[model samples]
Structures are given as structure tokens and as C-alpha cells.
Target: MKTLVNTLMMRVIEYFASKDMSQITHTLCVHEYTRLIALREGYKTRKVLLLELAALLHDIGCPRSKELYGNCLPVNQERIGAEIVSEWMPAYGKLAPKEIDWLVKVVGTHHQLPMAKEYGFEALFEADLIVNLMEGYYPKEKAALYEKNMVRTASGKALFELFFHHGKMDIKSD
Candidate 1:
């Protein structure tokens, strides 16, 4: 199952693999972070699996959007990405129809929504925020603002504190 999951992740990334390695690396980190956060929160296995998959494919539409619009705007990417993931979900195998739809929604609205509050969506959002903060993709003030106002999960809140607030490396046990 793990191998199949990994293979599916790669296949999804292949849709528009960036020449720059940063995007791929960021996605991988978000996947790991999402899994870690989910595990820490004691999320069930299937939800963790879905959240990890969302983390991997959240930016899958960026390359496609660039191809079509000459720029990967978050709104465009979110819209197009929903279409892409909807098509790709069945290829991953064994996902129920509802699970596929739910994942498609997660990937589609990941950037546009203010907050979802669902376990998988919250995990994905926080994991992406961690990468965005560390990579300087988001300004510290803005990240802090979001952390204060938007972060909803206990695990996510703890991670934000660990990475951005406390500046510590004791993430795994937290």
C-alpha cells in the first residue's frame, strides 16, 4: 500500500513537474509535516492518508495554470487543480467515490478558503503554512497573523509554536 501510495504521488506530480526543485521539495516537506501533525493529533489512518495525499497534490495545478495563463495565480491554480485532481483520484485506486470527491474539494479550495476546520483540510493548511513560513514565501507578520486568527487544530497550533514561535527542533515528539 505504501509503495502504491508513493507511486501515485509521483504520478500526480508528473502532471507538471517544475524544473526548479523547490516546488517538489516543498510539497514533500508539506506531506511529511501533514503526516506528522495528523499522527500527533491522533487522526485515524485513512484521514492521515487523505491529508498526506492532499499535501502532495495541493500544488498540482500550478504548472497547468502556468501553461494556460502564463502565470500560476492561486485562484486559477485552485480552480484548475480541482479539475485535475478529480480526474486523477480514480487512478490512485481503492478510493471510494465520496473520498475522491472529498479529496478533490480539499485540493481545489485549499488556497481559496479562509478555513475549512476539517481534519484533513486543517492539516494540509497548517503543513503548507509551515513550509511557506520557513521558505519566506509568506512574511512573518502575515504568517503570525494567520497563526493567531486562522490556525484551528491543536497539533497545527503546537507546530506553529514550535517552528515559528519557539524556534525549536523538537517537532517529532511534540
Candidate 2:
């Protein structure tokens, strides 16, 4: 299952191979970090894999958004990515419509607050923030505190705290 997921993810990367490679790297890191956090929380293996898939393709709409409007705003990006992923439902095999819906929503709003109570989206969102904090993209103090409080699962919090204090990425001085 894990190998299948990685293969799927790599295929996604290749499909978008003409796009910004950094975003793909960032997406994978977010998925990986989120998986680490979710695993510690005892989330089912299936759920964790779903979240990883969601994380990897969440930004899938960015290139379109960039070409159309020069931005990757949460709503716009998610909607676009969702539509794209939805088209793949036939090839994806066995995924229910609801699952696709959730994937769309997760990919769409990762930049905004988590709108669902389900821990899956929240975990994915927090993991992305963890990576962003490392990138020095979010304001340090707030990002630090967000890292501290927003995590819902045991592993989520632990991974966040580690990145909060020791992440390798630093803010580039403007």
C-alpha cells in the first residue's frame, strides 16, 4: 500500500514535471511530516495514507492558479486541484466520491483554518505549517505558537515541537 502510494505520488510529480519542482518537494515533505505525526497518534494506516495523498496533491492546482491569476489562494487552489484530482477518479480506482470530496477540501484549504472537525485535515494542515515555519515563510513567533497549539494528535505535536526548535530552514534576511 505504501509503495503504491509513493508510486502514485511520483506519477503526480511527473505529470506536473513542467511546474515548479520546489512545490513538489514542499508537498512531499508536508505529507511525510504529517504521516509521522499521524502515526504516533494511532491513526489507522488507511487514514494516514489518505492524508499523505491529500498532502501531496493539495497544491496540484497551483500552476493553473498561477497562470490564471498569479496566486495560489486557498479557495482558488483547492477548487482547481480538486477538479483536477476528481478527473483522475476513474484511474485512481475504488475511491468513493466522498473520499474525493474530502481530498479536494483538504487540498483547497490547507492555507486557511481547518474547517472540518475530522483530525485528518487538521493533521495535514498542521504538517504543512510545520514545513512553512521551517521555510521562514510564516512569522516566527506566531508560527512557533501555531506549531505549539494547533496539532491535534500526539505525534503531530511532537513533530511540530521538533521543527519549531530545530528545523533546518531559516528565514532569509530581507
Candidate 3:
């Protein structure tokens, strides 16, 4: 399973690299953040693998989004990413039907905030948020707001503060 996951990850990275090297960096950062949070949160091996796969593929729709919409807004990315994963995963023969369904949901809803948590995507959400914040995708005020609202796990919150807040704000967990 691990080897298969690694192979898929490399394939996805290659795909991202061909389109945009920056996106490959973003994907790797998000994947690392997801791994840290999931492991700290005590996710089992299978769950961690799922999270990693989702993290790698979360922005899979960006190229198509740019081509079709001339922008990669979350809405377009979500829709196209879900479609891409749904169409592409079966050919890889790596994931079961249920796993593919969950991956589709995670990729599809990764930008939908609390709703994504319902699909067991909280870690992916946080991971993506952290990377985006670091990359200055959000304004400072908006980043702070997102940190307060979206970061749920201890590991994620800690990373957010360390990277964004610089250990200044005393964030209380819900």
C-alpha cells in the first residue's frame, strides 16, 4: 500500500511539475503538513495514506481550472478536481471504490471550510490553509481569520501560530 501510494504521489508530482513547478512545491508542502497533523492526531495508517493522497491531488484541477475558467477559484478547482480524481483513480488500480469516493469528496470539498470536516478532511483543509498562508495567498487579516476559524487540530494550530502568528496570539482550541 505504501509503495503504491508513493508511486501515485510521484505521478501526481510529475503532473504538477510539468504544469508548474510552484504547484509541485505547494503540493509537497500541503502533503507534509497533512502527514504531520494526521500522525499527531493519531490517524491509523490507512487514514494517513488517504489524507496524503488527497493532499497531493487537492489542487489537481488548477491547470484545467486555469484553462477553462481563466482562474483557479476554489469552486472551479473543487469541481474539476473531483472529476479528475474520479476519472483518473480507477485506472491506477490503487484505491478501492470507497477510498476513491472519499478522495473525491476530500478533493472536491477541501475549500468548503467546516463542511469539509464532515468528509474527514479537516487535516487536509488545515494543511492547505497553512501552505496558502505561507505562500501569501491570503491577506494578513484574512489569514488570521482563517486560522481562528479553520485550524482545528493541535498540530495544525501550532504550525499556524509558529509560521503565521509567531507565537504571539494565545489561540484556544474548540
Candidate 4:
């Protein structure tokens, strides 16, 4: 499993590296935050790996979106990303069919706050949002609202507070 994951990681890194350096950086940052939140939440290794993969590929459609629409809006990205993951992962990563389906669902609904918990993508969602916040994609003032509405895992809330609020926001634990 580790070897397969390593191979897939390398493929993903190469894919993004060839396309856009900044996107690769964003993907890596989201993956790191996903790792931290998943580990801190006591998730087993397999689940963490799945979440990490989702994180790495969350924005996979951005380049295609730009090509098609001239802008990578979240809606367009999610749609194109799901298609790309559905087609690409099986050929390149050899993930289980069910795992591929889950990945498709996750990539499809990444920006839809309500589907995160429903699709078991809480970690991926929070991690992506955290990286977006750091990248100034979201206004800093809205961090608390995100915490209250979208964040669910204790680890996610804690990390959000630490990064966006300087560890000072009194976010109630999930």
C-alpha cells in the first residue's frame, strides 16, 4: 500500500509540477494540513492516506477549468475535477473501484460545505479551506464563520483557530 501510495504521489506531483508550480504548492499545503488533521483526529492509516490523496487532487481540474472557462471558479473546478479524477485515477493510480468513486464524489463536492460530512470529506474540506485562507482566497475576517459553520473535527477547529485567529479564538469543540 505504501509503495502504491508513493507511486501515485509521485505521479500527482509530476502532473502538477508540469502544469503549474503554484497549484502544486497549494496542493502540497492542503495535503500537509489534511495529514495533520487526520492524524490528530485519530484516524487509521488507510483513511488518512485516502484523505491525503483527495487533498492532493482536490484542485486537479483548475487547469482544465482555466482552459474551458478562462476562470477556475469553484463550481467549474469541482465539475471538471471530478471528471478528471474519475478518468485519471483508475488508469494511473490503480485505486479500488469504490475508492475511485469516493474520490470522484469528494473532488466533485469539495466546495459544497454540506456534502463534506455526508461524503466523509470533512478533513479534505477543512484542509482545503485552511490553505485557501492562508492563500488569501478567503477573507481573514470570515474565519470564525467558517469555524462555526463548516468545521466539524476538533483537530480542524483547533488548527483553524491556531492559524487564522492566532490560537485565540474560543471555538467550542465539536
Candidate 5:
């Protein structure tokens, strides 16, 4: 079952392979990081699967935005990506409509409008932040601020501290 889930997710990701190679790699990185963070935080099978899928498709609109506007604007990508996910989910993952909607919401809002206390959201947000940090896509100076303000889950906070803050601060599990 797990293999089936993962394979389908990978196929969905590869569906856009011709768009932008870097974006695909970025999604893959986010997917792996999301998986790691979710496991570390003791997320169960269903939640982990959802988070991973969200991570994989979080920026699915990047290529479209780049092609249209020559840049990846967050708002544009979010809107476009949600539409893309809506069409792809049913065909690729066999996800129910509600689950597909949930995935779309998480992927669309991950950048600017995340609500508090949501484990899947926090995991995907933190995973993308960590990858963006390492890839130099985002400014390092702002990571500390975002970590302080945005990260909610213990594992997410711990990973942020370890990567951006060098593990100087002690991490406690909730």
C-alpha cells in the first residue's frame, strides 16, 4: 500500500518533468524532507502520506508561472498550483474529492497563510523552508525570524534550529 502511494505520487511529480528540472528536484527534496519530519514527529500513515503528497506538489505551479511571467511569484504559483492539483489528484492518486481538496488547500497556502496547530501544514511548511534554506532560494538572515514565528511543531522547530541555527538550542518533543 505504501509503495503504491509513493509510486503514484512520484508519477504525478514526473508528469511535469518537462517543465522545469530544478522545480522537480525541489519538489522531490521537499517530499523527502516532509517524510523525515513527519516520521520524527510520530505522524501515522495517513497523515504522513498526505503531508508527503502536499510537499511534492506544493510548488507545482512554479513552472507555469515561470513560463507565463518569467518568475515564480508565490501568489500566482499558489493559485495555479491548486488548479493543477485539482485536475491531477483524481487521475493520478485516486484520491477522494475531499482529500484532494485538502491537499490543494495545504499546497496553496503553505507560503503565506498557514494556520496554527496543524501538524500536516507545519510539517510541509517546515520541510519546504529547510529545503529553501539549503538551496539558497531564501535569504538565510530571515530564516531565524521565520523559524521563530512560523514553525509550530517540535520536530519542525528542532529541524529548523539544527539546520539554520546549528543545533545550539535544545529541542524538546511535545
Candidate 6:
């Protein structure tokens, strides 16, 4: 199951595999941060799996958007990337339809702020927060302004506070 998931996600990101090494590295860090935050928060294994998808494909549409729109805004990329992910993920046979529903939404709108206080969406949001904070793209995207706006589960909130207080993105210096 894990291999299947990785295979599907790799194919999705392969769309941008040649564009920028930084893009790939940035994504890997996001994924790692997602796992750390999820485990640190004590999220269920299944939920952590969903968050993994969110991080891996978070910027998957950037290359396509650069070709068509000359810009790779997070919102647009996530929208298109979700469309692509929809093609392969449903066949994986792990998550229920409802889980898939939340997973799809999480991937699609990961860039934008939460529109509702929903669990899946908040999970993706908080995970992205950790990534942005680590990547030093926090305040630039106005994400730093949201560090205090915690949501999601108790574990998630704790992890968010850890990152929030650290203020540094917890990434490597060199």
C-alpha cells in the first residue's frame, strides 16, 4: 500500500521533475516536516498518510502552470495537481470514499487559507504552515501572520505551537 501510494505520488510530481532541483528539495522537506509534525502530534497513521500526500503534491502543478500561465501560484498549482492526482489515487483501495473526499480537498486547496474549520483541511493547513515556516516563506506568504491561528486536533495544536515558538523553519542551514 505504501509503495502504491509512493508510486502514484511520484508520477504526479514527475510532471515537474526536470524544472528545478530546489523545487524537488523544497517538496521533500515539506514531506519530512509533515511526517514529523504528524507523528509529533500523534495523528493516526491513516491521517499521517493523507498529510504525506498533501505535502508531496503540494506544488505538483507548478511546472505545468509555468508552461501555460507563466506563473506558479500555490492555489492554481494545487487545483490542477489535485485534478491530476484524482486520476490515479482512487484505484489505490485503501481509503474510503469519504477519506478520499477529504484527501482530494486537502490537496486541492492546500495553498489557500481554510474556508471552514474542517479537520482534513486544517490538517493540511497546519502542515503547510510548518513547511512554510521552515522554508522561510512564512511571512512572505503572510503565513507567519497565521502562526497563532491554531486549529485541528490536540496533537496537531501542540506541534503547531512547537513550530510557532521555534520561529525558525527547522531546516538545514547548509
Q: What would the TM-scores of all predictions be?
A: 0.87, 0.84, 0.91, 0.91, 0.86, 0.72
Model 6 residue 63 lDDT?
Answer: 76
Q: What's the lDDT for all of these models?
A: 0.78, 0.72, 0.86, 0.86, 0.78, 0.65
Q: What is the lDDT of residue 113 in candidate 1?
A: 38
Candidate 6 residues 1-174, lDDT tens each?
Answer: 567558756765565567755677777776776776666666787778877876777777677777778887876777777776676568777767877676667667776665425545455566666666668875634443565455555544555555555433333221
TM-score of 4: 0.91
- Judged by TM-score, which candidate is best? 3
RMSD of each: 2.4, 6.1, 3.5, 3.3, 3.0, 5.1
How big is the positional error of residue 41 in model 1, measured in Å on the Cα after superposition?
0.7
TM-score of 5: 0.86
Residue 122 CA error for candidate 2 (Å)?
A: 1.9
Better of 1 and 3 by TM-score: 3
Name the better of 5 and 6 by lDDT: 5
Better of 2 and 3 by TM-score: 3
Per-residue accuracy of model 4 over 1-174 as CA lDDT, tens digit each: 666666767877888788766897898888888888888888898888888888888999998898899999999999999999888888765578999999899999999878888888788899999989889999989999988988999988988878888876444353
- Ranking according to TM-score, highest score first: 3, 4, 1, 5, 2, 6
List residue ranges in candidate 3 displaced over 4 A. Answer: 168-174
- Pairing residues by index, what is the TM-score of model 6? 0.72
- In candidate 4, position 74 carries an lDDT of 91
Model 5 stretches with alpha carbons more than 4 Å out: 116-120, 168-174
| Candidate 3 lDDT (Cα, 0 to 1) | 0.86
